[model samples]
Target chain A: MPFIKVRDDLCKGCKLCITFCPKQVIRMSDRLNPKGYYVAELFDKEGCTGCGICARMCPDVAISVYREDKKEVPA
Target chain B: MKVVYERPESLLDVPFTYCPGCTHGIIHRMVADTLDDLGIRERTIGVSPVGCSVFAYEFFNCDMVAAAHGRAPAVATGIKRVHPDKIVFTYQGDGDLAAIGTAEIIHAAARGENITVIFANNVIYGMTGGQMAPTTLIGQKTDTTPYGRSVEANGHPIRVCELLSSLDGVAYLERVSTHDPKHVLKAQKAIKKAFQYQVDGKGFTLIELLSTCPSNWGMNPLDSLKWLEESMLPYYKPGVYKDIG
Candidate 1:
C-alpha cells in the first residue's frame, strides 16, 4: 500500500497537507510533538494513491509519500 | 518504495516563519526547486521585500538581500547589473509591488531589466497587521477598511499583471494561485518559467501568485483556499498576461 510518513519533530501541525489531500488519508493526531502542535498521521495506508498532494502541500517539508509500484528517479 | 516528493535542496533547513497555512512557504519551495533544477542555486541572488516576505532571506538557501520597503525591483536591478552572470530574482507581496514600489516595478519592466519577480498577492498586508492593500478586492473588509472597500472611495483593485502586460519591455507575465494542489502545480510551472526567462536573457519576467492570508482573512486554512478560488479568482483572473518568450 502507498503510505505517508511525517517527521514528527519537523511538523508544525499546520494541517495544510491534510486539508489539501483529495484522498482524505491524513488526520491530525491528538498527540503533540515537541513543537506542541498536533502532528498529522496517515489514517489509512490502503487509500493512498501517492499523488503527492500531502507531501507537496506540507509547508515544513515534513511529509514524504512512497508508492511501491513506482520506480525511484535515480539521483 | 519510490519517494514521490521531498523538500527541495535549494531551500534552507531552517523552519519557516510563515504563519500556519500561509502559501508563502509553498511559493518559497517552488522557487528553490526551480533554482536547484536549473543548477543556478550557486549563482542566484534573491532580494526580499519589507512585507511578510521580509524574512524570506532566512528561508531560501541562496544568497539573499533585503530591500527597503517596496524597493526590491531597484535592488534586483542593481544586483543583476553588477553581477550580470548571476541569476537575480525578487520575492514581493501585493502591498510591496502594487502600492509603494509601483514606480520601481514599472521602470524595471520599462527598461527591460533581466530579472525574475515572484509576486505573492494575498490582498492584505501580512507583516504590519492586516490592512487593505492596493490589490484588495471591492467590498473586502480589512483592518483599515472596517465596513468594506468602496470602489468609489478607494478605487479598484490593481491587477498588476494586466497593468504590466501593456509595457513593451516585459518578456513574460503570468498570474497563478495556490488555492489547490493542481493550481499549486501550475504555479510551480509559472515560477519556473519566469526564472527560466531570465536565464535565457529574456527581460523582466514576473509571475504573480494569488496567495491566501488566512489569519487576516479570518478564515481557516481550508476555507481560505476556498475563498481564494471563489473571491480572489474572479477579480484577478489567472492566465498569461503576456509572453514575449
Candidate 2:
C-alpha cells in the first residue's frame, strides 16, 4: 500500500525517476509544467511497492513516497 | 502518513537551477542527507567554487561562502582554520579543481588540512558552454576541441584520485560514477564516508564523482549516461584510491 507523490512545480520533466522505478509505476505526463518540462505521473498506483528508488533517482528531489504500514501521529 | 522518502532537511526548499538532467542536484541532496544524518547540519560550512556549482551557497542549508575561480581550497582552509570545530567542505568541478585550483588543492592536501571536498568531473565545462577541462579525455569533442581532443595538442586526462593517492596528508580519496543506479548508490556511500572522515577530524578527504553533462555532451540524458558508462569509466576507473586511517 505504498504511495508516491510528485511535486509538479519542482519536477523539471527530466523523467529520470521513471526509468529508476523498479515497478514501472511512473510515466511522463502529456501535460507540461510551468517550467515547460513534461512532469512525471503515476501510471498504476497498485503496482508500486514504495521502494523509494524513484526518490533516490530523482535529481530534483521532487518525488516523495510513503509506505503503507507507517502511520504518522497527529501534529 | 509516514514519509518514507523526501528531500533531506539539510537542503533548502527552493528548486535547483542546474540544467536539465544535471547530476549536480543529486549530489547536493546526497551531501545534505549525509550532513543531516550525521547531525552536523548546524555546524557545517561549505565553500562554493566557480563553475556550475557556483550557486551552491543557495542550495545547501548550512552556512556557505563563495570563492574565486579555483580558490575554493584556500577559502575553505581559511574558514576551517578560523573555526576548527566547524565542519568544512569545498564543492568544486573539474575545470575549477583539476585545472586552475590544482596548486591550491595540492598544497592544502599536502598540509593535511582537515576538510572534505566534493569533486565533480563532468569532462567538459558545463557552465562556461562546454569548454575543454583538464579531465576531458582524448578524442572527445568540446567547444574548444571541435574536431576532437588531439593528444599532440592536449595532454592526457588527469586522474584526480590517482594523483592524490600517494599523498600522506590524504586520509581518504575515492572515485565514484553516477551513470547507473548501483553506482549512484555506491557514490552516496562514498560521499558519506568522505564527510564522516571530516567529522572524525581526519585530514584531506575527497571523493571524485564522475557525472554527466548531457547538454554539453550533445546527447540526450539517457544516451549521455550510456556514453559515460561506455567511454569515461575505462579511463577513470572507480574505486578506493586511498583510505588510510
- DockQ-derived CAPRI band for the predicted complex in model 1: medium
TM-score of 2: 0.97
What lDDT score goes with residue B54 in model 2? Answer: 95
lDDT of 2 by residue, B64-182 (tens): 99999999999999999999999999999999999999999998899889999999999999999999998999999999999999889998899988998888999999999987789
Q: What is the TM-score of each predicted model, taking all chains together?
A: 0.95, 0.97
Q: Which stretches of candidate 2 lie over 4 Å from their true place?
A: A70-75
Off by over 4 Å in 1: A68-75
Model number with the top DockQ: 2
**For model 1 chain B, where is the 10-residue window of minimal lDDT?**
B1-10
DockQ versus reference, model 2: 0.65
Q: On residues A1-75, what C-alpha lDDT tens digit does candidate 2 reach at each position?
A: 677999998998887888778778899988888988889998898887777778887888898988756443111
